[model samples]
Target: MSALLAEDLLNQMIPPLKSTDTTAKAARWLEEFHVGQLPVVTGTHYQGLITENDLADYENPDTQLAELPLRYADTYVQHDQHFFRIMELAIQNRIQLVPVLDEQQEYAGVVTVSDALAAFGPVPGPAGQGSILVLTMEERDYSLSQISRYVEENNAKILSAHVVADEHDPFRIRLTLRLNTDNLARITATLERFGYLVSAQFSGTAAVSEDEQDRFDALLRYLSV
Candidate 1:
């Protein structure tokens, strides 16, 4: 599946009104859209966003929406930004909607979690863009240290490293490394010298080998199951 773009996910027509808007109107919009948060805009510029929590303190359902506290997002993505990045932003902030802006900072639209989720499919994204390396070693191995040492020694950084027991063989552990480097042969050679057996390397590289594809599939199945 392909990644979604902020522009593709943007709900430009669903812009939220200013704080000066009546609480009743805002509530109605929330109900109509079924969104917990709405992006507020003034003319063509973005002002802030209003969330459902801000409505809690209001005793009157008839209260002025503008009177509700505004919760703003410090990070807003331009319309040109990738949808995957938008999803990350939403998850990090625990918000559902992200306001999209043009290069001129004009309010272009909004990226909602629902739209993004639908576009991108299942997430807490499972082994999508980065590289994955499968290093085979003994159960007594301090896998992380070995991988870190080799990665750093190679002038590339390790984004993440993990160790999982070889399901079919408990005595062996599969050390997975998400790294900055894509050179499989070079990485494998370095680790092999340190007594680590590199089973496979998976990455976002255009040309994925058969073994890499199998490992990628294995990762997805593991994550889902």
Candidate 2:
């Protein structure tokens, strides 16, 4: 359940410029790269980043790229930052392309809005095609999808999955998967063999034991806790 990092999502080696570069060159880079902004740097150190809106003042378009006031990342992040924070910056600023920097303040890459959306958007959970094995797993474990694929390949169908960060440890996640349970026993065995921390059952005869009374008791306990 290791989530993608901002640096991994960022597009750091973006179109860049030296302070002395001309505005025309900047505009050209913007158009050529099909980007609205370009990060301006000096050597490996980040000097500033500039956008077309910042350049709109210069109708001439011939101004020196160096002369235009360069803007920097208002909420820029280091290269090793979390992806969720990067999403917050893009949504708050209403801009694309989040710049990433190294410890030396040097340009690393850029994280585009598209990448963040792709990574953070609703993704299919385990038991993708058939019945799901809803449970909790250590965040460091990366076999969630693998386990789901195995279930699906064996003729089960995964309905849906919900994942929540563990309250006790952020590094663990509680996953609830809904899967078609035609062969419930086999599915459970497969999941257990694959190292899934099986905590509950949710289908057919096995589900009968977990009726409304049980659900109510569980809810009460949860609320009291």
For every candidate in turn, the CA RMSD to the true structure comes to 14.7, 12.8
Best by lDDT: 1
Per-residue lDDT tens digits for candidate 2, residues 1-225, read 344566657654465677777777887888887778777777766666777887778877667766776766455777656554564565446556777887777777778867655654433432222232456688777465786787777777665555656546779776655565534677777777877777655343344454533442332222122
* Per-candidate clashes, comma-separated: 4, 19
Candidate 1 backbone collisions, by pair = 19-66, 22-65, 23-64, 23-65
* Candidate 2 minimal-lDDT segment of 10 residues: 216-225
lDDT of 1 by residue, 1-225 (tens): 232457777776586676567666777798888888888766776777877777666768777655555666466887756554564566557677888888798888888766665654443434454455767778887556656878788777776554555645769766656565545556667888888887766554436777546555544343333
Q: What is the TM-score of each candidate against the true structure?
A: 0.52, 0.52
Candidate 1 has a TM-score of 0.52
